[model samples]
Target: MKPGRYIIPKGTYRLTDKLYLTKNTKIIMDKGARLLRDHNAGFFINGRTGDSFTGYDGNGNITIEGGTLDGNLTARYKHYNAIGLARGQNIVIRDVEIIDVRGAHAMDINGCKDVLIEGCKFKGYDINYTVDGDGASYMREAIQIANHTEAGFNSFGSFDAQVCENVTVRDCYFGASANNPAYPAGVGNHGAVADLYMKNIRIYDNIFDGMTYAGVRPYKFENTLIRNNTFINCDYGIRYSNPNGNGTYDAGKAQSGRNTVIQGNNFIRSKIRDIYIVGWVKDGITARVKNIQILDNIFEGVSNAETMYLSFCEDVLIRGNISNITSRFVMGYYSINVSVKDNLVNGITNEVVYVSDATADGSTSYVGLGYTKDYYISGNRVENCGRSAFNMSGLDGVEVHSNVIVNASTETVGTRSAIVATASTRNGHNNKVRGGLWIKSRTFLNEFTVDDYLRKEVKLIVAKYTK
Candidate 1:
């Protein structure tokens, strides 16, 4: 039914199956107002201000178009999503701005299907003063997706049981103030602006800034694609994990989280690490991570703490990226079947790559073989590094060939090793070190070339390394 030119006053509950607000009319769900059981319908709080609408046990679909939902919405106690397809199908929330909900989630989708959230702005309330020890607190997140259970809904029971499918979030903006008290004191433990747990998801072309946590967190699902997003002044740009107890979490799971792709994004001024891939081990056996590709991205002015941290995975590829002004590029522990190539690191302070068989506890305890075979590090460039440009410790069957290293020196002595191979039991060969000024003993069995650029590419190949 159409309610033409009506205003939902403050502190009132507008309950209906399908209620439509006419164009240019106002429906205000003022401070402390609620709406319940809007089943299989649509509501247009069209072009209004100071209108608040809350849904309880609401199902099917609801649309808040071109207006402001300026109050709190509570789906924590209800059994359905606060917005979009709550135990229903095909919901859409477009062109709305929601704000000033203290410690409340913006939207929740439970067992919903084919949901789309576009052109929306979700933000937390601003906080000015902090109570010293009690950091800052505001509205939690913009959107959440999970499944239903009997153990008193909204608790998010098991990672496996919460099955959300075919979700899309595009062209959205998520922002929180930096002065919020809940901001982390150090790196590696910040909160995200949005958390997503679903299958067959596509998140693209969004802008996320001033968030205390990760920009996007995808947990326990597959065939997910995160591309063309901008993350600024946040802690972690994106984090992918498998919270379920499955031995394999790729784009091939029952929900298809097995083959995930993160490509063509920008991460700038991140307070902590930019990207993280965490695998939860069960029964003393590590999970297999396959077909995870990170390609064609730019990481500029990233924090010096850590950039890319990978743990317990196989068949991972990191290629065609550019990093500037970073402390470390990649740190791997207990990783297998990995390839890092065709990347540029300019003005790096620490080692470009640190690989070890050692876990946190330095023992001869080999959890598994530290194998880096059939690996290639080619067509990369490093300039003005503070420490060793390349440090490989305790690696097997590795190759560091056809790379250019230039101007690796500091003020304090320039004694840094250009390429330090510590206790390497494998063959290190065919490495052409370009440019002048070489450090470390040149007693290793490898070919070295010092070519003149004016001689072109033909005569220089026969002149430098052969002599």
Candidate 2:
């Protein structure tokens, strides 16, 4: 209990056990300090207490400030885990108040390096749901940046899978706790070990509310930086993946570790996707997720999902965003060098930028198909589109230019197409749009349409996709 500073004075202690911090420890709690664990035992702050070190080389410069650790686990179900830290280095939890967490993680940060969680407030989360079998606690996470697993029992001493480097979660406040629900991931990492990764993760200015799953999930991470966060109703606000990475097309995998940067976030009303980047290849793998960057974000009110969903990625970048989505704002699949730039969309019920390459038939080995090549849609600014704004298909070096559509063809009765291009393979120039550009020419087994669209202004707005 002593390597230096203590302070703790100002109230209710109650903790039946645990609370073993060591090595240059510094706990300062005054503003009504609280600490209440008081029963159904286990951790309140027991990273296997002190140092008899093993893996990740134990006992770091610990520091916990301003208290309230209350894992009252709401009604019962308490398999434990409130503030468990495994291996460590310069750790510092600030302005704390971690509440009601049950069935794991309110802050389990195993194999840590320079960690710093600031202005904390993580609220209640009691969903054991009889512990989902192999999926373990299913999703659970208030702030678990782990490695050194046992499905994140986090190997307190031995398990050398160590890796949780330079983490930094800032200005926190994840919600939910009038009695459970809301923490299926606020900051994550659920198992992954292929050249052990986790490095330089930095989630900024957080506020995630109602996170039933992913407000920031980055497994096997490396140089991640989800900036300026504020997701509400998350169902996947940022679920960047790397489950052992894609070994080309998933055979003894190992590749996801590159620069990830979802910048300036604000996503609201997201119940499905508000930035979900996955990369688990198939159809003879080889994309394996590369440098991704979705910048200048600000999406609002999109429920059926899709305000950003890039899968099986390669060098990608969707820039300067500002959307008011109704559906698909940027959905690229089986990607390659993708670059949708200068965005400013509004109420698009269909394509505001939908690139594709893999809806099967890439020579048919199936899994998830695969084929997109270099794409570059530029200077976007669509408005009220009910169908096409730029809905490309399988490609080869394509480039849609200077976009600026408005009141796009209300629906598809006479197809007012603002650039549809189905079997993609060409360079579209100066796209300004009052509607006029369809192009369906495939030629693999004959599909031929080759440009046709002339239904001067109709209006319905139903939306299904593909034509």
Candidate 3:
């Protein structure tokens, strides 16, 4: 047992093999115990249960509790990693502090199941941008669960294949600098996986505060639940990045997970988009998330970013949430079969929930605003919005009804419209906005408006079809 305040002195330690911790093994470090790495070592512990990458014998019943693995960032570092788990089962890492990790992940739960990381603290890794001269910032996520190997961070091409299942990260403190002088802080939790599928990952009740990157960046997975978390002033909250790390969007190329539930989370002063959505970069693919239910969330005083953002998505439901001080809650490009209902949006300085077919890169040969279709925005309450209550640029079968939209902006000239179906693209057809109380209204050809002044208490505004 390495006693308290032990120093892993300055030397070449790659000659040491990893600590193979398996069945019913418990390694408990006492208080104030520490492992200070003088060089950037490969991994602190390795749990490779299988001989090959294609299978796993399932290493089980491992518990590592309470110690500080401190990657002395000031040292001439070594390889990039902390703890790499290969195909493990029932691993519980509790009350351990992984700090100054400087290179790669704190816990690389690769091909694992039933892993729990709770009551720990993580900070000051590659976020400060001191690498091994390769310019590769490997320590992107504080705790990343991926299908990659014990090696550094690698994305999927055509040949990558693995899966992680039943992982839970709860009651942890994750903080990176909001403004690191050398490097921008990395994402709190990241998934840059492709081809492979993950299942039953639940991240709840954690505090992600003051990160420059995203709070939870889910690239692709399945059956994931992120609930009851608190995000304070992160760059982006619950966002996504490049779909498959490639340009094109094919199911075989890359795909987001189906069956995700993001609900009951709180966001305070997030810098960028609070509820972010990322699709394929250049090519038009499906949404990064499908069959998603985002419900009962609260966004307070979100500054300078869109409160909610959606891009290429289908079969999604955003309901029963409240957001205020929003910039623009816009959904652009190739969003299909979405429903935004029964939500309260207040003090929206930009579009409450606008729809466009504009991709991120704007090089959508097959993926453009013309392809965004079949969204139902109904039963929502909007108040004090600068732009239109509904800006309908998303094409085909768009229905906006039964909503209260109050356009109260300081500059009221180009503001008070129930819907703005512009003549920009051919996306101005077959859309309808009806039965909403708009304090004012506007008129476009395909962007029609229905203001039912006959209703004494409410003004119903509906716009359908343009010439």
**TM-score for all models, in order of appearance:** 0.69, 0.41, 0.80
Instruction: Name the regions of candidate 1 deviating beyond 4 angstroms.
Output: 1-62, 72-85, 125-141, 150-152, 155-162, 177-197, 244-257, 359-368, 371-374, 409-413, 424-467
Off by over 4 Å in 3: 1-20, 47-54, 75-79, 127-139, 150-160, 176-194, 245-252, 281-288, 359-370, 413-415, 423-455, 459-467
**What is the lDDT, from 0 to 100, of the residue 1 in candidate 2?**
61
* Candidate order (lDDT): 2, 3, 1
Best by lDDT: 2
Clashes of 1: 17
lDDT of 2 by residue, 105-155 (tens): 788887778989999888877654655333546577788887765555543
- Cand. 2 Cα-lDDT: 0.72
lDDT of each: 0.54, 0.72, 0.63
Question: In terms of TM-score, how similar is model 2 to the real structure?
Answer: 0.41
Candidate that scores best on TM-score: 3
Tens digits of per-residue lDDT for model 1, 218-322: 655567788888888777777655543432222222211357788898988777777777664455555545567888888875536566776655667888888
Q: What is the full ranking by TM-score, best candidate first?
A: 3, 1, 2
